[model samples]
Target: MGSKHVFVVAVIYSLCAVAVASNPCVSTCAGRPTGDYQSRNGCNVYATCVNGYICDNRPCVAGTVWDDTLKRCEMTSTTCPPNPCVTSCNGLVSGDYQSCNGCNVYVTCNAGHLIDNRPCPSTLVWDDSLRACARTSSTCS
Candidate 1:
């Protein structure tokens, strides 16, 4: 795959922290707080909303910050950058989406972005079409 854009980012703690910050009550993206107005210079590279800040039903992208003055998330660089949406959820690691084998075998993000290569349990594996876990035993009764 070819890379499209490269930009700076201010992570709050990790990807998960950013996800929670996306909530209506969140106050900041990294360290920059959300309010009725924040100058472009005041905004960080990336930020979430606080007090239910909603722009087009979406949060600002990473490598950019929420511009309350402009009423949108704008790029902190030369121009609006690529998708800065980092997936943080349920207090899990930035990329740890679903758990398997009751929390042992699971999927997660590498470096809080890309999907990690960790596999399922030794006796279990993933079935993509089924989108579920299955036993590795070739012969099953």
Candidate 2:
């Protein structure tokens, strides 16, 4: 009976070992399988290869700063502007539309540009003559 118990314990131990070996490491503390470990570059951990980099062993590319805000690699000089305007007009007299507001301003440049609506309405038109937003029909020019 003693020998049988020992045999059973040995069998259980062998099975547990096989199971552990067959399964991938559950935590990073234990060394990973041959090709399963991730690469560490700077403060970033890459799960897989990107661009031309090899799996589990590539360094961070130059000129790229790790962005904690975006949680990825980004160029150091990449400027995030507060408000980007697509269209801007200059040199307005008293009646011209000086600036377009909002995230995107689509405008066709003319003497005093008409934007959004045809012969743009007073509200939307950018009056180049006035140097300030004015009614399209006001006609600073």
Compare the candidates by lDDT and give the number of the best one.
Answer: 1
Model 2 agreement with the true structure over 17-50: per-residue lDDT tens digits = 2222332212233333333222222212223333
Model 2 TM-score, all chains together = 0.17
Q: Residue by residue across 48-76, what tens digits does model 1's lDDT show?
A: 44645422224346545554445466663
- What overall lDDT goes with each candidate model? 0.36, 0.31
Enumerate residue pairs that collide in model 2. Answer: 93-129, 93-130, 94-130, 95-130, 96-127, 96-129, 96-130, 97-127, 122-136
Worst 10 residues of 1 by lDDT: 3-12
Q: Estimate each model's TM-score.
A: 0.21, 0.17
- Name the runs in model 2 displaced over 4 angstroms: 1-45, 49-54, 76-141
- Residue 71 miss distance in model 1 (angstroms): 7.7
